[model samples]
Target: METKIQKWGNSLAIRIPKSFAKEAKLDYNTEVEMTIEEERLIIKPVKYKKYKLSDLLKEITKHNIHKEIDTGQAQGKELL
Candidate 1:
């Protein structure tokens, strides 16, 4: 697909069509790396580490558990 380059705040910008964006898993605030290869502009999504709650929980043990902290006396109605 051909996309026209438009002026965007003193820089040239091109809009990626929805179909292409979806195929590349691009969404709002997604980080992408841009480079030039063989006189062609290449845009690739930066892979981000995805964390799962269950996987994180498996690493916790009694040896690494933190003790409770004391904040002196409560200033509000938290005592109630």
Candidate 2:
């Protein structure tokens, strides 16, 4: 199917037809990863590997420690 790129506010946007999106199981709020190969733009849905917190914590050892990540400055009621 062919689509035309149009202006959307400050960015260019294209509408994926409903039939195509439905066939690919894509909808609003679905995350997609976009990459450019040679001269073509490829977009595909992001597949996330599910992990449980308990399973993740099992890999932590005594030598491992949590590092503080800077999340910018606190906003609203967030405590430092």
Best by lDDT: 1
lDDT of 1 by residue, 1-80 (tens): 77799999989999989899999988888999999999999988998789999999999899997898999999999887
Q: How well does model 2 score by local distance difference test?
A: 0.90
Q: Model 1: what TM-score?
A: 0.58
Question: Which lDDT value does model 1 have at 51?
Answer: 98
Best by TM-score: 2
lDDT of 2 by residue, 1-80 (tens): 78899999999999999998898778999999999999999888999999999999999987896787899977878884
Clashing pairs in 1: none
Show model 1 residue runs off by greater than 4 Å. 49-80
